[model samples]
Target: MKYVALFLIFLAAPALAQDDPAVAARAAAKALEQASEQLDDADSARDRVKALTTTVRAYEDGLSAMREGLRRVSLREMDLRADLAEREAEISDLLGALMTIGNSEAPVLALHPSGPTGTARAGMLLADVTPALATRATALKEDLKEVSDLRQLQQEAEQRLTEGLQGVQLARTELSQAIDSRTDLPRRFIEDPVRTAILIAGTDTLNDFAAGLGEITQDEEPGSLPAISDRKGYLELPVPGKILRGAGEEDAAGVERPGIVVGTRPRALVTTPTAATIRYVGPLLDYGLVTILEPQADLLFVLAGLDQVYGRIGQVLPAGSPVGLMGGEMPAADEGLSQSGEGGGAQWTETLYMEVREGDDPVDPLTWFSTDKG
Candidate 1:
């Protein structure tokens, strides 16, 4: 029976911890500190960029946790206020009764007890109850003090939330600045202004544009480029998200597209899964801003649906370099259907359309990245 009772107590501990706002706040703080340490320990520019992005995300998460803690504290304050009000009412009633009895005449007081013997018994009862009343008054005073302390805590939490939000904003600015400064990469291709202009003007669709790019010749063969073929099924995703559509999947327009769509958080940072040279970074038709990267002499990666592009054309970028940011809210893919309906609703704010091609042939991205389908 003792062991069973101990086991039950252990089982209930986690539930109690979950209810504690301070526990969540501490966890968020710890995560933020670890991310900051990673950012400080980063060796390469690419690693530093990723670390900075993670730190920014951690800061945002910490602020959210703090705000949740504040909310819980506010709720507790309300409960304390209600309890204090009830205690005050009880104290008022007790004081009113004492005043009424004190103002009564001696004869009236004796009559209230019925006779001499009854009056003496009543006095003895009052003597015993007076101590109990004093204890209740002391408890009420302590409750009032606790309510004051709770109000102070509530104020502190609100102030901390405000400061935390400002700190997160500052951290985001620093991350962006770090990415902008780290743009040095060994180039494998030279920009062909004439051919690029012709392709930009002639292409009617993304497929055509990709095909046109494939035909453009490189200036020199990059012997120093990393072997991307050897790293198949081991590449990390450019952004943290879930795969929404696979290669050759039918899109909302009922067209068979040759890319995967990933659903990510709004304004999420897009990074390179492997070392690559920037072939192009500009706006394309319907896909918003686009970035094209060549990981190898024969392999090209196309990324679209960006709100802003970071690197420039012909720039060499190492693996994990920041490429762009996901776009914000936009109109739905189809107009007649609700956003929640399949293919009819508003386009997701952070949907990344990625395509991997080897020598003009589209390849399944799932074969490259280790993704959790479940």
Candidate 2:
């Protein structure tokens, strides 16, 4: 009967040992799955900051879940440790009881129960309990071994969760930078003279022209030009006289002219257009202080023989802004005109030259205009 009881206790030990480690591992895996789902949802919607934040939160939650699992594992280990300790103490007590039960003096003492041998009676009970004590001690030692294995598992899970949190932080930083890059440029161009005519030309031709201008691409993409119904295209000066000269011309060469010589600036020549970006504020050659109105419609219109240059690079002006003072020293306005004749005069002519390059090939500006009479 004693041996049978000991055999049953040993049978129960293996079952208890199998349950704890399996339960902890399952709980940790479930927490990780939930965290992964949240990260995926944030990424799909294009909100990088939100996605990174979600990942961080998920990692935090995972850490909490892992810690909880560790806590449960630790508790389970403690329970096993306590059980082992209790069983050890119980085995010692049982051995004393079993020895007393199996003692040879036990049967002889039964006839003299009134004698002063109570301690001796207990000795026989300890002898009968001895085999049960040995079986319990071995079972409890196996339980202690399980607690050690569980402690190692908890440590490994903690280390992985720490690494996951760091990865989340790095992702958040990059997403913020990407968002700033997309929104940094101006929402609209503010009354820019150089870009306004380009916009009027329509989308396709403007894009083609802008592609050829390697330096201009750095600023902004050229937009479509607005359509004008009249097709007056650009206004031309009706009166023939020396108006302005461009930079490189036969007469203006080395003469320190402000603008390219097309015609000499007549003393009473009216202000037709404004200077664009004032590249050179001071007077140059036969031309007075010349300011190159940043080109419009692929035409670099020079306002030569100017007493003043009124605008800066980003400044916008209405038509006929005063650009320069009239003087004979300035280049003639009609110096380069094909129909007009060039003559020796302090009065210079200014003719508009259109260099319409598809890429590098210059096309005649005369063909692009609506009216040839200008």
Candidate 3:
């Protein structure tokens, strides 16, 4: 009876089994750790804004991984619990059998009326059964232990999420300020405000305004930049997002444009996909804020719906240079807690309209840019 009591107590302690989620969690944590270290390194970087940009992007990647890992951890826990629940009756029966055996008299246990031959055979069978029973008990213990660890990981992740989210926001703010104070970039031509205003007032559509770019800035130059002809279908998106509406696809309002609609998270960083001259910047028509880049003669890349804009008209920007940020406020870290089982990919509610054109004619943006990556 004393031995059975000790065995039951051992069985009551939790253990472990499958480790797929733990593997993912550890990888995510590593990414977060690297990003955290990079955050510190960015402070002393010579190009402060550029370093901050990298830091923010790293944090984004880390947070994204952590969110996915947490989601997987939640699902794994749920599955183990469900499996254990289904085998509850079997576990109860096993425990009851052990109790019964422990309560029996030691001399009566395995004793048979057939004498020594029967007793020896019974003992041999008990040895084989005991190993199998112990194996099942160990497996159950591991499952319980895994469940406990998953729950603890989840609780601790909230604090990490809070720190990451706040860190990214601070990086973004610093990048914006750095950009404002920057005077290092060269300009191709100065924008004539009077002509720009006149063009805006006279134009009825984006096509009309874009067609008159020559009238707004007569000294515009894009010759030094290499032609993007070789880069056709290879250029990355200016922002990190998924294609919400493919080129020419209609939205819920049933209005379809030749351009694509990208779904992105709040305050996502926007960058130049390739070296290009900024032809136009600021609000245009109903589009919130727009940045028009000319990579080659007769080719234009237009991105609209920005919360903030960087660089001015005619400033040549290199590939991957920070251009702007997507609109919408970053959600509080606590707000993400309820999204435990739903990965970060599902959280994009903000939209950015991206378009491409040959002169004033609208064209399929996908033809010039690749969508194989985020």
Computed on alpha carbons, the lDDT of every model, listed in order, comes to 0.65, 0.42, 0.80
Summed backbone clashes in each candidate are 2, 77, 3
Residue 190 in candidate 2 has what lDDT?
38
Q: Model 2 off-target regions past 4 Å?
A: 1-26, 29-47, 91-142, 171-374
For all predictions, the C-alpha RMSD in Å is: 10.3, 32.0, 4.5
Order of candidates by TM-score, top first? 3, 1, 2
- Relative to the unseen true structure, what is the C-alpha lDDT of residue 222 in candidate 1, on a scale of 0 to 100? 40
Best by lDDT: 3
RMSD in Å for candidate 2, one decimal? 32.0
Error of 2 at 156 (Å): 1.3
lDDT of 1 by residue, 136-252 (tens): 556556656756765675566555555554555565566777767775455666777788788988989876787787455457454646677889888888877778888887988
Which is the leading candidate under TM-score? 3
List candidate 1 segments past 4 Å from native: 1-21, 33-54, 60-165, 181-183, 214-218, 329-349
Between candidates 2 and 3, name the one with more favorable TM-score.
Answer: 3
